[model samples]
Target chain A: MSIPARTTEVIGILGGMGPAATADFYAKLVSITPGASDQDHLRTVIWSDPTIPDRTEALLGKGPDPTPWLLDGGRVLREAGATVIAIPCNTAHAFVPRIADHVGLPIVHMIGEVARYLTSLSPRIHTVGLLATAGTVRAGLYQEWLGRSGIHLVLPDNASQDHEVMTAIRKVKAGTRDDTTTALLTRAARRLTARGAQAVIAGCTEIPLGLSADAVDVPLVDPALILARALVSRAGADRTAR
Target chain B: MSIPARTTEVIGILGGMGPAATADFYAKLVSITPGASDQDHLRTVIWSDPTIPDRTEALLGKGPDPTPWLLDGGRVLREAGATVIAIPCNTAHAFVPRIADHVGLPIVHMIGEVARYLTSLSPRIHTVGLLATAGTVRAGLYQEWLGRSGIHLVLPDNASQDHEVMTAIRKVKAGTRDDTTTALLTRAARRLTARGAQAVIAGCTEIPLGLSADAVDVPLVDPALILARALVSRAGADRTAR
Candidate 1:
């Protein structure tokens, strides 16, 4: 990890992707940063409004439009003095484009960063399997990013897609990881591997609850972690050309 | 829950006790409210700046002063449109008195509401145990409030009090909990019951992780719930008031 320049970067995390994950990111900051104490970690501003319409629900039309609430989140973090902003929710990245224009601060894109990370992997793998909500998959976000780098992005077949992946996402949101949920996720992971996916992007943060690195043999890419590294970089973790 | 008057009463949550609970409260509004969509839940302004020095650390001299952070939390919420603010963090309630004057919004007291709940529990109850951080017990905030009602507030003996409870708080902040941590908390709860307490006010919001109502024979009061109820009332959950 590079030491971000000493130029006080007040990072803004647009969180509330299940409240626990937001906390996890902050905790990760503490763990990863070269800090002498809590104060030494990067100064951060968090606008964790979970009230925004559920991203998958909005995308599926099972819930209301998320544009206004998301806009509120962006404007909020912007008003709060975020030098740069990040949204921890994987699916919410869908609406970020609409809201980004309203906020003054530039957003460090999570999907873009993860896509870039996969392309920059050791030995540079050519393919990745995506285990995320159908909303994210249907939008072709990962596929679009990977396509730019001549990398192939794969998804589970229709039979295995919604039932396994979406169910795991719901279970995590409900704070459940019972044996049944665990088996469902394991089965989903197997299906992705069956599809010849070289690596699986734990695209939805929730899936990581069940499919840890030990649970599956394939390389797992956590979008949130990639986002954090991007944050550390944006915070001036390295002396590099922007 | 009382129906709030027509005026959009501003509710400021003086948070950063740890950022998770603050976000949890915000998410709960979106969940439990009668809104068909995102806009229906009460509009909330949260200041979850975790850089605020730890109230416990600050008060105990284990860390720097958190007064500035607490004051900043208050000022931000007031400027954001909160008519009255409720601090979700129990420890930070120590400075509510000072923060009230600094901001235009009236500060809702989490400790006061917990005291009221205890009072309504039974006519014979005069003593209640507080299982909170050393900072909270040292500050005498709750003891002072109960003293006004001619009631005694009991605290754990020195043996039962120390880093155990605070460590549990940090664990919750660290965003990881295992069965062993839960067992450690249960041991602490049993000790609180042995101290001749009728009820244990989960004095620190983090303590609820370690000890629950079932862990001890006595009733357990969660200060966060009291704060939540107070917020619901302010938002006009009471139809009679309407």
Candidate 2:
């Protein structure tokens, strides 16, 4: 990754889905950036409010809305010198467009990055197996964004989609990670792979902790990686290294 | 490990002492809590601001002061519903007391927790080995706090102290887990254990990731772990099962 003028624009992190994912994004941001000293890397302003109501639960009306907190963070980042914004949480994207509209900063879209990666990786690849929350799927975030990128998206079969993919996300949000989650995700990944998916997107950041690159025989692309790579690029770090 | 009839008060975490510690703290809070569900656990609010200036550099005038960010988070948590406040970053403790004064909430002291743990684990514990940032040490955060807790604290011999621990922290901050760091910390741990430390507290959150409990062959007490246990106790989770 080439350094542009030794520093780039400051990056803003709209996190708080859970502290772990937020931390992971910050590490990945520093990992890909070129810096002889820590100060050389781009400055960051992180609003990690883990107290935000559950995205899925709220979407399902099990809890209060997270929009107020989401909007608060967006405005905070904008005031903190964050020229570009990125959210590490997949489910939180449900509120991104709303927050982006009000907050007024360029939020590097994670879903778009995933779609763009798929298109750049394979000319023949048609459909992808997406493993995300019920809210993300129901909201059609990935489907709608991928549509614009010209990539066909394949979701988990209806029978198991909610119970499997969504359950995995809730388990993580609730701080639960065990074999039950592993079994559920693996079955869905296989189901999507079998249907027509050339690759699987571990769309949720928490899913990767349970499912790794080797878990499934098919290609597993982490959307967070795409977001981090894009952040590094926006921060003026070379993208080629990624 | 006993639960009162009433619930434990909520904790607001002002973090971003890099992201790993914040994630570890949240996980630890869950691990130590006696909860069966999300509500079963105490409510938490975390604000991780990694952009806050480097403590060591800031104190020495090599960088900007982070006191502003620290104060901002404290106020945010106070307004948001954090009954008590704590910072996961050891170095940040230098400014915590000042921040605590303005926040209007009881700031659970990380160094105080460490001192209490040392005293309880081994009454005879003296000449203890602490691995934290140069600023934390220079500020005598532990020395001052431990004195009140009634323990003698011995720091790493200056030559080995400053470079290795700070270097290890930077590597983890940079997301590198190379063997050089592994060996450096391993040897540092050995020297500290030999210096009559009943146990070595990986005072720096980043240090524990590189130096595992197994590598040094001494009882390793991680501040992050201590903070988590304290958080659990504060959360007032049910302890009937235990």
Candidate 3:
């Protein structure tokens, strides 16, 4: 991680796959950074364009591709002097490979980071449940990465995915975080754990908003929080590298 | 408000007077926006440079000038395709005048919006108390704007400003929002209300984080929330101007 003294790491958030999630991620980043003052935190540039076509819809072939929008956001960040980019959306990672090389800045692979995090845990998580958009499941985002780390993923059935998981996610996105939404997510987690999941991954960014870690019987992991910590750790590493 | 159909408004947030305040402002903005999904939210670019020197220290002649950093941030946002800029930090407003014209984008005045908001209230507040950084107080950021609206401003004496208000703000910035911080702010607000203040403005962005509306007997005004509403209103107006 050694670098020149002048190389300051600025984190670029390519966000707004949904705006709330982006805000949540940034808040977490600020909260987790080891700082006594403002100057102790990382320098960040955030480009949040909510109009970027839906990533899940794109993956399902029901909407236009978001590659150009993601690339434009990356370009905006790089041009604005961001040294590294972090996209808070989990589903949006499906298109990350398409824009990563073209964006010219190193895009932190959130899913890969999540995989590393899960494996790094004490008494290493052998089996995890995923509650994410069908598009992420269709794209095998968690499956591909978690498989490499020797972690098994348990997902909801199609009926439960539509009726319980997605409805709850949509309700959260639309600004409803009531008992019903939490119940829906909790029920989905129960079903996954019933199928032998040791822990649950709040795979969708919106899920963490509605589902608390204590809601389910097993530990509920938040990828966004993990990604925020990873970003903070990387920024610190880059800061002192010489 | 009339404009061509193709014209779109993008919000540029010049933040990171402390990173948490910036994150809080964005969260409030997202929470308050009238939206059903991601596309319904506004497009925003945030440049949060925490390394920007302390505004209050600069105003007190104890630190270096922050105008260069402010100008640099404005340029970054404008170049990132932001059509209008909104600075979340109240103390940083002192330098807004220096960078407004040079940034090549309209900077929304947060303090002015707060004055207008107070004047527009049904009860018609005549005198409002302020809880802000010493820099903002010294710069007369709120005084000039509130005075123009016929609103009398009640400020803390030297003792309260240092021992209670500024300490509370600093505690919140250092990520400590305990009962002690809240009590300090509450005591400050009580002293102002004792002086016949109708409402207390959370003049500093950090004030709202530590002191809730119910903590004070008088209405607690959050300038950050007001600023978020103003940005949303202006964005919506610009959006439908055709």
Candidate 4:
């Protein structure tokens, strides 16, 4: 057999917080990549250990630490020759710093990418709304990243967060995306828009499955898509660096 | 970090004929597996090399050979500790024997699984229609396998094969699944059923993206789903054997 030149970067995914979300992220990675043939895409190694303890539950102190599982997934990727890593789930990013510390591989930060993507928008979107899980909201992932970039994050009020956003996220996880979930999420986006938000960031990976740009008035920025783009760029840059 | 027991089988995928099909297959793998948490899902390693030369073109003697790339992908999976491998693309399976020979890893046969799935159906499906790429049809991958199992195979007329089946498959690869493509495929399915096909196998990976059980009168057996089930079963069996 002839050996072809290996010219692309291998992307290791620390995933499986929710299997569907991991699949969604991979699908986005394939969609956003500009490749004509089978070899044109980035070499991706996905360690989808759906057994990684719940990130949101862990963040809320209601579940076991996911650090061990995240680290294990990272090690699998690193040992598999992944030059860079990406975590698809937003809440999972809470443990990424620790995971990165353990694996010592560059992680394409999902929240940081969302912040960067929002900044790159045509009108320079500043006031953004976040519709994420309670754990991610409580952890202030988007708030911390976007705040550093001088972008204001408008979140749903506590009542809305508990009733609409969290409920919608659960419905999405349970494989239910009925009109009720869509209407509820749309209302939440409208409330954020009313609060002077320019666009809604589907911070939780599952949120984008049910809510889309058409469901909301302003653009619905998908962190998964943003992360996928960031990964492609990182992989391409790594190839050039090599 | 605690070293958790490695009990599950790792499924290495030789994929990326078209990136979307590979993603679709992985998603089906996740969806069909019986899992409660991340660890409940089978450990999967996917080497999605979209750069693998076009399998259809190669089989038609019109493009470069993909065997080298397939072998390379299999080697990646094998070195990553994959006990067994699966190829998502139906056409790519034409090179599986050579790949299996090179890697010395068991590959969950996609077409074989489809034949088995049809046999398992209630009332026992006898005449099966195949809607696949010209490569799969020309290579007689299904005929050779199903012939042994005593199942009858019906195919689309040459005109429909080139116009409808090929066109629909190309549209799916281009990430376009519009009404026009759907209609073209559904018409082809009707023609196959009219020719005495009891059920139509969405033989090509891209067919399922636009066509479903509801789209056609006869049962539309999806090879991807069948392959996913086979992979899950194989992984579970491997774990049990250990």
Q: Which stretches of candidate 1 lie over 4 Å from their true place?
A: A1-7, A15-38, A49-69, A99-102, A167-184, A209-215, A236-242, B1-11, B19-44, B54-65, B81-84, B122-126, B148-151, B158-189, B209-220, B232-242
In candidate 3, stretches whose alpha carbon ends up further than 4 angstroms from where it belongs are A1-7, A237-242, B1-7, B237-242
Worst 10-residue stretch by lDDT in candidate 3 chain A?
A1-10
lDDT per prediction?
0.69, 0.74, 0.89, 0.82
Which of the numbered candidates is closest to the native, going by highest lDDT? 3
- Maximum-DockQ candidate: 3
i-RMSD of all predictions: 6.6, 6.8, 3.6, 2.6
Cα error of candidate 4 at position B20, Å: 0.3
Best-to-worst TM-score order = 3, 4, 2, 1
The superposed Cα distance between candidate 1 and the true structure at residue A176, in angstroms, equals 8.1
Point to the candidate with the largest TM-score.
3
**How does each model score on TM-score?**
0.77, 0.82, 0.95, 0.89
Worst ten in a row by lDDT for model 1 chain B: B30-39
Q: Can you tell me which runs of candidate 2 are displaced by over 4 Å?
A: A1-12, A18-20, A41-45, A48-54, A57-69, A72-84, A237-240, B1-13, B16-53, B57-84, B97-106, B122-127, B231-242
Candidate 3: docking tier: medium
Give candidate 1's root-mean-square deviation (CA, Å). 5.9
Docking class of 2: incorrect
Here, model 1's chain A TM-score works out at: 0.91
TM-scores for chain A, candidates in order?
0.91, 0.90, 0.94, 0.93
